[model samples]
Target: MFPIIFVSLGPGEAELITLKGLKALQNADCIFCPETPARDGRLLSRAADIMLQLDIPADHIYRFSLPMSKQRMDALNAYDQVYAAALSLHHAGKRVAIVAEGDTGFYSSIHYIYEKLQAGGTPVEQIAGIPAFIAAGARGGLHIASQEERLTVIPGITTADEIEQLIQSRSTVVIMKLSQCTDEVHRCIRLHPEYDYHYFENVGTPQEKYICDTRQIEALHFPYFSLIIIRHNSF
Candidate 1:
C-alpha cells in the first residue's frame, strides 16, 4: 500500500515550506492542491506556485477545488469528493501528497480530509508548517502569548457576542479569516480599546502589510487570508 502525506506549505512565502515537506513532494508520485477562484474566473493554486518555486514538474501536480462554505451539507459533500479522489490514487499504487496552506491541523481544510482518510483505515502522514498567526506576530513585532497568559485563536466568522466575551477576558486573541466578518471584528475591537491590536495581511509575502492601529482595519480591503492579533496589556 502506498502512503499519503499531508504537506503544509506555510503561510504565504514559497520558500517557507519545510525541508521535510519538500522531500515529501519530491518523492510523491502525485501531488494534490486546493485551488481558489481567481479574479479572472481562472483557478489559482498556491501549492502549484510552491512546486514551481522548488522546480517540481507540472505533470506531478493536480489542483482540486475544495469547498470552503460554512454550510454543513456543502462541506460534507466537498470532503467526500476530495477524499474519493485521493483514495482512488492511493489504490493505484501512487504515493500522494496533499498540500495545504499553513499548519495542517490548525483550522485547515486538510484536517477534515485527513480525519476522513484515517477513519477509512488509510495511513496518512502529516507535515508541520508555520501557522499564519505566528508569522503575523513575528512580522508585527508582537508576542502572541507568554508564561501564564491565555491565547485564543478565533475564526472571524464566529459570532460577535462570543468574540466580545473572549476579548473581555483579556486573553491574547488571534482572529483569522477576517475577510468575511471585518465589520463584526471592528466592532469587537472598538468595544475593547484598552487592548493593543494589529492587523496583518499576506505575511512573509510581497503583499504583506501590518497595521498597528485598529482604526485602519475598517478602511482597507481584507483578503480571505488576513488575520488580526489583539494583545492585552502586552505592548
Candidate 2:
C-alpha cells in the first residue's frame, strides 16, 4: 500500500520544516498543499514558496482549498470530499503528503482526514512539525509554559465566554485560527486587563507582524496567518 504522510510545514519559515518533513516532501509521489484566498482574491499559503526555497521539484504539487467551518456535519462533509480525493490518489499507488501549517495533528484539518481514513481502514503516517505557538513564544522572547503552569490551546472561533475564562485562568494560553473571530477575541482580551497578550501573524515569514496592544488592531478583518498568546501573571 502507498504511504499517506501528513507533513507540517511549521509556522511559516521554509527553513523551519523538519529534516524528516523535507525528506517526505522530496520523496512524495504527490503533495496536496493548502491554499487560501488573499485580500485581492489571489492565492496564498506559502507551501509553493517553501518548496521553491528548498529547490524541491514542483511537478507533483497540488493545491487543496481547506474549509473553515467547525460544525460536525460540515466537518464530516468536507472530510468525505477531501478524503475521497486522497483515497483515489492513494489507490493509484501514489505516496501522498498533505502539507499543513504548524503541527499536522494540532487544531488542523488533518484530524478530520485522519478520522475518515481510519474509519475506512486506510493507513496513515503523521510526521510532526514545529508548532506556531512554539515559534511565537520564541519570537516574543517568552517561554510558553514552565513545569508548574498549565497550558491551553484554544481555537479562535471558541465562544467569548469560553475564551474569557481561559484567559483569566492561570494557564499559558495559545489561541489559533483567530481570523474568523478576531473581534470577539479582542473583546475577551479587553475584559481581562491583567493579562499580557502578544499577536503574531505568519511568524518566521517575510509577512510576519507582532502586535502587543489590542487597540492597535483596528482592521476590520483578521489575517489568516494570525495567532494570539495570552499570558497571565499568576502563572
Candidate 3:
C-alpha cells in the first residue's frame, strides 16, 4: 500500500504551500480535503480552494466533513470516518494526501487522522506549512520575537483565567481559534491594555483583515478561523 501523507496548504493563499507540500499534492494519486462547517451561510474549505488553484483535477480530490463541536465523541467520530476513507484509498494502491489549512500538526483535524493512521500501522508522512499566526505577523510587519524572548500559543477555547495569566507573562502570545471565545478573549485583552495586540481574520486570503486598535476588537465580528497575537511590551 502507498503511504498516506498529510500536506499543509498554509494559511490560505495557494502560493503559501510549502515546496514539499506542493510536490506531494502533485504526486499524490488522490487527495482528501476537509470541509469546514458553514459560517454566515457559507462553507469555506481552504484546502479545497488551494487544490483548485493548483489546477489539481477534480477526480483526484475527495471531501470529508469535520464537526465544529467541542464534544470528544463528535471529534472521534469525525476522525474515524476520515481515517477509514483514507485507509481504504491507501489500501487500493492510491497514494493519498490529506490537505490541511495550516501546519498539519498544529491544532488541526489532520493531527487526529494522523494519530489514527499511526496506530493502525499505516505508513504516513507530514509536510510542514506556515502557520496562521506567523503569516499574520508578517503581514502586519510585527516581529513575533527577538533574542531571549519567548512565544506562547494558546487556543481561544481556554479559560479566561488561563488567558489572563498567559497575557501577564513576558512571552509573545498567539491565540488560535479566536472565533469561538471572542467575548472572553476580549475581556482578557482589555485587562492587559499595556500590550500591543493585533487581530487577524482570514489571514492570506482576499478577505484578510487586521485590527490594530484594541477598541475595535469588541466591535468586529470574528470569523471561524480568526486569531489574535499579543506582544508584551516588556518582551
Candidate 4:
C-alpha cells in the first residue's frame, strides 16, 4: 500500500524544511501543493517554490487551489476535494505528499485532510516543520517562553473579549490567522498598552517583515500570513 505523507514546509523558506521532510519530498512519487489564486489569476504556491529551492524537481506535481477562507464549510469542502484526489493518486501506487506551509498541526487546515485519511484507515504519515510563530520568535532573537513560563496560542477567529482575557494572563501569547480578526486587533491595540507586540509577516521568505512599533502595527491591515506575538513588558 502506498503511503500518503503530509509534508510540512516550515514557514516559507526551503532551508527550514527538516531533513526528514526534505527526504519525504525528494522520494515521493508525486506531490500535491496548496496553491492560492493570485490577483492576476495565476496560481501561487509557496510549497512548490520551496521544492524548487531544494532542487527537488518533480513531474507529477498537483496544485490544488485551496481557499484561505474563515468559513468552516468552505475549507472542509476544499480539503475533501483534495483528499479524494490524493487517495486516487495513492491507490495508483504513488507515494503522495500533500504539502502544507508551517507546522501541520499548528493552525493549518491540512489537518482536516490528514484526519479524514486517518479515519478511513489509509496509511498516512506527518512530517513536522517549524511553525511560523516559532520562526518569527527566532528571527527576532527573542525567546518566546522560558522555564515554567506559560505559552498560549490564540486561534484566528477568537472574539475581542476572549482576546482581552487571554492577554490578561501572565504568559506569552501567539495570535495566528491575524487577517480574520481586524476588529479584535484594533480592540487589543486600544486595550493593551502594557504588552509588547511583535508583528511578523511572510516569515522565513524574502518578503518577511516584522515591526515593534505599535502605531505602525495598528495602522496597516494584517495579511493572511501575518502573526502577532504578545508578551508582557516585564517578561
lDDT (10s digit) by residue, model 4, range 178-235 = 8888677777878886779899999999999999998888887988889998888886
Candidate topping lDDT: 4
Instruction: Please say which candidate is ahead in TM-score: 2 or 3.
Output: 3
Ranking by TM-score: 4, 3, 1, 2
lDDT of 3: 0.84
Tens-place lDDT per residue, model 3, 49-69, is 888999888788888776678
Clashing pairs in 3: none
Off by over 4 Å in 2: 67-82, 159-161, 217-221
lDDT against true structure, model 1: 0.82
Give the per-residue lDDT of model 1 (tens digit) for 40-102.
788887768868888888999887776556676776676677789889999999999988889
| lDDT of residue 77 for candidate 3 | 86
- Give candidate 1 misplaced runs (Cα > 4 Å): 72-78, 159-161
User: Which candidate would rank higher by TM-score, 2 or 4?
Assistant: 4
Please report how far candidate 1 places residue 43 from its true position, in Å: 1.1
In model 2, where is the ten-residue run with the lowest total lDDT? 66-75
Alpha carbon lDDT of each predicted model: 0.82, 0.79, 0.84, 0.86
* Error of model 1, residue 93, in angstroms: 1.8
Query: In model 1, which range of ten residues has the least summed lDDT?
Result: 66-75
